[model samples]
Target: MGLLAGCWSAAATAQALDAPNVVVIGPNLVTSGQPTAQALARLSQQGFEAVIYLAPSSVPDAVGTEPEVVAQQGLEFIHLPVPFGSPTEGHFESFAAALQRLKGRKVLVHCQVNMRASTMVFLYRVIFEKESPASAWESVTRVWSPEGPWKRLALSQMVKHGIKFDPF
Candidate 1:
């Protein structure tokens, strides 16, 4: 009976999180692909206080009304706009700053499909949150592995922090 309950609980949690490629690092931290307006409402119900969007609103698939939707749901929306083809270290700094301010609050960092969001979250996890590289790596790679510019950014941050982990 206990095993059955546990399985049911896991299923319920999965059902509750309906965003694309959603990853729950903990109760307070989540990363995902673009959340629809309805999904944003669900996130509000789930107790997320802020949404950090990494992709530019100009992206072909991005939701133009995302900011307004998040506001209507009473969640703070922070868009850092990391370009998919040319993410920079400075961009990471801005993201880190927003997260630092919202630290300990329920925050959702997302991009179109979790690739950019996951990589930035991985860096913030290892460097700012002081989590083990392996732990953070596992949290992110489950969504999508970083590559090219994204992978280079992650590797550079690791080097800058003097942490060692080889994902390549």
Candidate 2:
């Protein structure tokens, strides 16, 4: 019975950690495709301190009440409104700044489907966190390869930050 109970608890913990398109990047960071209100509620329990949304709030299926839900959960919410087709350096700058401000706090970064979120996290990890470029790029590719504007934005941010790893 003890063994069975232990397995059940482990399974329950894993279920609780589940989020839309969830990618557990590390202890301090997670990236997801989209965030529902219910998912936001689970964040605090999962040890997240804040959320960084990389797309506009209206980008198809976004929970319109995210701010309220996040507030209710006592977690900080920051929407960066990155346009999927035209991501700019300004957006990355803002993301990096917000992330830096929240340093050491567990943060969840999400976009419509993890593409934008993954790339941004990859860049942040590689540049600011001194993560291995190859390893961090693995998480980004697990969602999707950044192409078009995403590719351009990723490369440009790398250059701006003086990181020379070409993950393309």
Candidate 3:
């Protein structure tokens, strides 16, 4: 039964790696929801080279010790600490800069439940990667359909980047 259990565990890992909320934006880029310490260790074991955390440590669900854990696991950790309702262009810029610097490394970008990560990744793809807005939007919507301030933040960044979106 150990073999069977191992198979089931592998299958579960694969499924989690393929979950819609774990958005693989590129060969080297992934965006996911907040992950526990165990999940961080697993990600390191699975060859993720770096983690960019967009959620503040003060966030209700944040694991405050994640940075230290990630470092102990030998994965680079970058913390940007975006607020839930008010993500700024500077935040996006920093994230984009980190991504550019880490190009070719397998990196995970995560925020609380992926809301912030997905939106930022969408903007990054459309603005910097030259991906079509429609395609980027598809990826964003797959994880979550942003509304209210989140939607406004996305739209504002799109405009700043000169990527037009129809409001209909």
Candidate 4:
């Protein structure tokens, strides 16, 4: 019975490891595709009151136009210039601070592809929110970022912060 229980638990946890929705990290929060007017509208309809953007250095025309449009929609916007694989200490501090500030507020945080977005979210969930490692990982996978160096950077951030979860 004990062995069966352990196996079942492992399986259950593994199944939960599957990704969650691409949008909406939580019920009131969302992170959509590169800043499109339509995507911003969708997030607004979902009730996100604040938006945190981590976009590529070279923002596209459609994406370039989003911040002003989103702001005009009456949602608060905070933009971070986060190029992949180059997360600075200030970037992590600001990101973590933003996460903390937005706690319980209707917020949406996103990067162009959400690879950096998801990575930051995972670290926030684990370190600040005190979520279980499994739960944090679940959130990470749910909005798994595309293949990039940001993933490695995120793991390094965790190690630098002295979190118990091993990146390896």
Which 10-residue span in candidate 4 carries the lowest summed lDDT?
12-21
RMSD values, in order shown: 2.9, 4.3, 5.7, 7.8
Which is the leading candidate under TM-score? 1
Q: State the local distance difference test value for candidate 2.
A: 0.83
Q: What's the TM for model 3?
A: 0.84
Residues 104-153, candidate 1: write the lDDT tens digits.
89898989889988889989999999999998899787887888998899
Higher-lDDT candidate among 1 and 3?
Answer: 1
lDDT of 4 by residue, 1-168 (tens): 487775664454323322223544455455544654656665555466788887664855326666676788788888877867677657878888987787787777777666677777777777777777666676666656434466566667677767767534
Worst 10 residues of 3 by lDDT: 11-20
Q: Model 1, residue 90: displacement in angstroms? A: 0.5
The best candidate in terms of lDDT: 1
- The clash count for each model shown is 0, 0, 0, 3
Per-candidate TM-scores read 0.90, 0.87, 0.84, 0.74
Comparing 1 and 3 by TM-score, which wins?
A: 1
How good is model 2 by TM-score?
0.87
The stretch of ten residues in a row with the least summed lDDT in candidate 1 is: 6-15
Tens digits of per-residue lDDT, candidate 2, 62-126, equal: 88988888878899999899888998888888999999999999888988889989998888899
Off-target runs (Cα >4 Å) in candidate 4 are 1-23, 143-152
